[model samples]
Target: MNQLNKILVLNAGSSTLKYKLFNATNANKTLALAPMISGMVEIGEVSKVTHKSHGENPKKMELPDANLNDHRSALSLVIDLLCDPGFGGLASKSEINAIGHRVVHGAERFKNATLITKDLMAALEASIPLAPLHNPANILGIEVATELLGDACPQVAVFDTAYHSTMPASAYLYGLPYHLYKDHGVRRYGFHGTSHSFVAKKAAKHLGKPLEECNFITCHLGNGASITAIKNGKSIDTSMGLTPLEGLVMGTRSGDIDPAIPTFLNKQTGMSYAEIDSMLNKKSGLLGLSGDADIRNLQDRFRAGDKHADLTLEVFAHRVRKYIGAYLIQLSPRLDGIIFTGGIGENSWILRNKILKDLEHVGIVVDKSKNEVDLTSQIMSVESSKSQVPLLVVQTDEEKSIAEQTFQVVQG
Candidate 1:
């Protein structure tokens, strides 16, 4: 029997930890679409753990009474579940050859998947200020995994900002003092790079061209959204700046606002800086506009003739459309394709149609029939026959991308 290397991918959010276990080999072939085992642990007062195994007879179970109050306990429970005879794919934790973590901010130092060493951990710790909400959880996952899995099992840090490292100074720099960028790294470090890079590769494959030869615009429109202009498979520009809150209008995030709005609000409402920040990041966006953050609910409201929902949906579409127009100009003349991925981007055909409505004059014509389809698990071209550039919906797999990079780093 051929030996298979077990690679575990971990994405630790502020209050949740998600994991996937893939059986990999050093062969030049495609990895499996689904993982052998996948699970998530929600950490809180009443913690819970859910596990699922994929195969001929897939099984899923939930432990609502899990005693996981922190990331360490959460990950330890994940290890236990992975070794549980009936629910796990591994015989023991030692079978895990390498671990991959989704580190949110790599700053300017890491441009690719890096093998996690003591120095790398320190570097990641240094970047915590750049991603206060995300990096701590990611670092906690790495630390706990290292303590549990020991030094024998290699680990890799797959950064969310690595792919955007290819962005030029013209795109990344803010108009602030040059010293801010030189000393503090205060510039546009785009997020969702893993999804963008993964979908861009898929789109390039669908176009029958090498990624390096393709110039395209990729939109990753999830709860946290960002759009990128890819020139020759490299990110030349992106919407998100410095943080995930600067891009397209998202679930709860106020995408782009006047720079002085916060200060003005502080003066007017006497709210603290932290309070204003929380309101912008948590109380704004669709929720602030329409009183609801979920797009499906907002779509239903829009269909039911709610004027507020209508306006909110229009506002959301307008921002996305504006970015598409800007990126189109950035990759003009030789633009190959435009891609849509993420939850809302993949399923919300209404928003897609709204964004593409009057873009035909710019060669972006969407086929109504092709635009409306179930694209959750497959790739489809929604561009009309008359459209100059192909419009594709490519489902993103960041975990798979992380696993692949982790395997490569371990092999080397």
Candidate 2:
């Protein structure tokens, strides 16, 4: 029998805890999906909780809403399900070797997955201003996990920003004066590093090519989108910067807007600074374009001749195409292919077809029929005799990557 390292991977979002229990040491299958569990919590209304396993139907149990809601109770519930033998828990909590928390912002302090220590938690807290919405919950997860598991069970911080730390000054820096960057640490700090890294490696696997021998433009297009140009095995460039708001058009984000527009809107409309900030972050993007940002619904509307939905899809594709063209120039001679992943990139055949439709001039082409078919392969490439730029759609697994890294870090 082969021994496997069990690492519970936790991706704590604002109101959702998306997790998977993975056997990190299984050479034949490095990661196994946990019974998926998620749903609303102490959010807008009362703190309502809904839970589920990956394969089971969602079951509900209610209690008085926790006044000061946070990740603690959520963590407790998670532990209970894992430890309770009657609940079909995977292991008797003790058998679970470690924890891996998906931390969105590690600032510059963390570049590698570090064992969650008090000192590390302190650093995560200090960097909260950089990612006020995300880092706090990440810190809460660490604190709660440490409290429950104690120092004996190793926990690791898998940072979303760490992989992009390799970006050079020219790629990360803005044209603003040097003092802003030096004094305030105000510069591009890419998010979704884990996803980009996962997709890059996955791309190589699909192409049957050594990662060191290939360079491609990787697009992680979901509601929150980011384009990355991976040179060989490393991240040469990516879309997200400073915060997640600086990239491609998302479900509800104003990506790549004029920096001065916020101030302009505030002055002209007598809107509060907070209001403008919230507007750009919460009420823009495809939502503003199509009257609804949902891809499925919006696509349905487009088929029914809704001009706005069509326009929204066009803008989204245009934004992507522009970036694809830009990255082509950036990696000119080394560009081998264009790869797409993330929610929309993985499932939406129409979007993929639209994005790659006109790229023939750039040696980028796709087999429409192959792309439309569904199959799980490392590489989802089109079978085209004359196609130059190899277009691929790869399914990414950032959580498994985190779990693998967590196991190694704990073992080492």
Candidate 3:
């Protein structure tokens, strides 16, 4: 075992493979924090491969269109480009000591990142129904990497649901049929584990407090949104349920509605289950709420007095506020502060104003001047009190977490 530093982190979606290779040496040794080399290869109805080395702008990898048949080929091309020196590629395949994967769901089976093995892969594949769209791609990437790297280089699986595995039964269970709940493993296992975990840790760092002593709520808002109740470094509860489709109104997914919706719509439109699922998962959410899914579009429509757009934003903000207050009440007196991360949470000050506005009665206030500060900086706080609960805006780095876990596994 040598001084482990470089780590390759892979984040695979249904049709996109995004990656970042990080160099993490002993923090005390050198000041040159290794650069992040990243890119995404999108392979779906339309195919495109892109790569960016050392945080530079991505170069279009002109891969042979016909040869790139499936996910496997996509992975192969990615490896080649990462090794290509003409581009920002790391210039050597051997630079990656270990690979860490972003696995979407692990149910209750995994509480932390585990080294990927044949048995673990099978278990991950079995959990596919719980994450029909995400886990398969992640698993595919692991297999492809293992085939190319072999057992000599360890690979790790970091579950998105792992952080929320600490949720108490009261928060995770639903009053559905007992058999369905027991048989299908259909219970609320929240997603966005790594993002929430990263920001929560980031909050602790910014607050200059021991991570184990911090209690906070972290909202990861983006196209996919979720709020996590972090009590002393563990996820006690979260907004997302058994699936990512259950919580916040995402860019293109319906979060929640009446349980009888499918039956009612079936009778009305005679749509099949798959068709309805697609509509709810793909065609709904902000897109369904307003006329379009783009937040800018929503903003434009709202300014133009589009009722639905305004209403949609209201519903979105309302849900976030509800969760904040709910967690406040649930966690009570021990609550320290709230943290925000992810795309919308970190960048959208308007959203911060909407969620944090008028919360003075609950001892929450925002100094508009501080709120308007540049988002690129961390530790964003609006209100300051002598013993004030901190409202922090942290930019999350889940890839670093993945690499750290991968390093541990490889070292072991």
Task: Pull out the clashing pairs in model 3.
Answer: 367-382
Candidate 2 stretches greater than 4 Å from native: 26-68, 84-87, 375-378
Please tell me which predicted candidate would have the highest lDDT against the true structure: 1
* Ten-residue region with minimum lDDT total, candidate 3: 26-35
Per-residue accuracy of model 2 over 1-412 as CA lDDT, tens digit each = 1356667888777776656666544556444434333333453335655444444554434434644256777767667665545433465667668888999998887888998877888888889989998988787777777887788888899999998888778889989999998987788888878888887787777778998888888898888899987776777777788899997889999899888998898889999999988888888998887678789898898889988788888888888888888888888687777888888888888788778886667677788879887647756786366787778788878887897788768767
TM-scores for all candidates: the values are 0.97, 0.90, 0.92
RMSD of each: 1.6, 3.2, 2.6
Measured with C-alpha atoms, the lDDT of residue 98 in candidate 2 is 86
lDDT by residue (tens digit), candidate 1, 146-191:
9999999999999999999999999999999999999999999999
Q: What do the candidate models score in CA lDDT, each in turn?
A: 0.91, 0.77, 0.80
Worst 10 residues of 2 by lDDT: 35-44
lDDT of 3 by residue, 254-309 (tens): 88778899888888999988899999889998888776887877877877988888
The regions of model 3 sitting more than 4 angstroms off are 27-33, 55-67, 304-307, 384-388
**Model 3 RMSD in angstroms:** 2.6
User: Which prediction has more favorable lDDT, 1 or 3?
Assistant: 1
Ranking by TM-score: 1, 3, 2
